[model samples]
Target: MAETEKSGNAFVETIKTIVYALLIAGVFRTIFFQPFWIPSGSMKETLLIGDFLFVNKVAYGYSYASCPSLRLQRFGIDVDAKDICGFFDGDNTRLFGGEPERGDVVVFRHPVSGRDYIKRLVGLPGDRVQMKAGVLNLNGRPVEVEDAGTFEEVMEPQGPQRIRPRCANGAVGDGGMCIKERQIETLPNDVQHTILNIGPQRVDDTGVYTVPEGHYFFIGDNRDNSLDSRVPAAANGVGFVPYENLIGRADRIMFSSAGRSMLFFWTWRGDRFFKAVQ
Candidate 1:
């Protein structure tokens, strides 16, 4: 009887420890940082498909969007951020809010789909943004973009999604060399970053978009492959994201994996560990 009681006590202690650990982790994620996994090539060379980073929640202060949304299809658990902190939304305000500067890479909730998206903030409130002839135009001036050779990669299934990359060098067989024209784009704020172009697309030329108050404009580093503020939300694009939807800014990549699973230690990208996000 004594042995059984000891084993029961140990089990109870273990469960309590797990519960306390989970609560601490939850508070950390909600208040300070949020773990974000790069699941797409939209940001491309700047933020790859397998990059893992922690978003600094305190960067833009707190809002309803700061609350984590738990969605696990396999577990049948689907909880939206609004479900947890919906009352804090709708006013277009934040707690201890700070304005996000142009050219910062940020993660936010999609206004329509409620999915989290990471993109480079390009247009601020009251800014006129447009894409004319493959060049980004801000306030009627074309942003500087200089050719920087080509970005090359192997043509193969990437990450768990198995999504193949779109190449400027046309269709490529598996394991073949894939290429995209690379350019160094300088935002108005003087922040420079690499952008990949895959020839011309409809989004390359768009009418002027006047960013509304309390909203922001974002775009992907992979210009031709992204459906961002260049398209409207109704058309399956990001459109103008509201300020309250802003979650946090991604400062640096904690680690990166080039394989389908992070457990595949052999597929880790050593150089990208602790790499600063440009």
Candidate 2:
């Protein structure tokens, strides 16, 4: 009887230990850092579709929005009087922190949808932003871009052909036919990064956008592909993101997988492990 009692006690103790460990981990994750997975190819070469990265919570300080524990209290503005969750409306305060600088890749809450979004900070408050024929113009000055060579993606095999060509010029000229224009773009602050131009898309040219106060303009490195601040909010694009919705900056990639399934060990991208997000 004593032996059985002791065994039961040991099991209870083990469960208690696990619960405590989980609580500690949850608190740490809520306060200091959060993990995010890249769900799309918007950032492209800078951040791949299968990349997993860490967002430093302390980078912009703590806010009601930053704590997962307080998610229920995070309110949103009513898009229309008929919308659900329209009753709750107010702004959360961000305590102690600085604003994001140009070229910093950040994660924030979408203004309308309340979904999380990650993009590069291109324009600050009160900066004039425009894209004229694939070129980015900030405050009336054009950003400098230099050719950085071609960026190619291997097309999925269809039937007998193992590798298919999908170049920029046509349907299939050569194995490396469908090429994207890659260039090194330097921001006004001297922060340099690579951007991809996939020909003249809808957002390649845009009218002048004067950024309002307390809001920032964001864009993706995949210029021709991203639906960023260039697109209007009415069109389902992220408009000028407010300061209150700011989350944190992505510091580095923790791990990456070429294949979406994590169960496949062979699909692990060893090269991107611990790679810093520039």
Best candidate per lDDT, number?
A: 1
lDDT of 1 at 66: 96
Per-candidate TM vs. native?
A: 0.98, 0.84
Superposed model 1: Cα runs more than 4 Å off: 1-4
Local accuracy of candidate 2 as per-residue lDDT tens digits, 1-278: 99999999999999999999988987887678888878766787798777889898888876545644223334753332214223322554467867789999999878887777899999998999999889999999999999999888765432222323234655644334356788999999999888987677778888899988878899998777677899977789998988867778999999987664656678788999999999
179-261: candidate 1 lDDT, tens digit per residue: 99999999988999999999989999999999999999999999988878889999999999999999999999999999999
Error of 2 at 159 (Å): 21
Q: Give the true-structure RMSD of model 1.
A: 1.0
Off by over 4 Å in 2: 69-89, 157-167, 172-178
**Cα-lDDT of candidate 1:** 0.95
Please report how far candidate 2 places residue 194 from its true position, in Å. 0.6
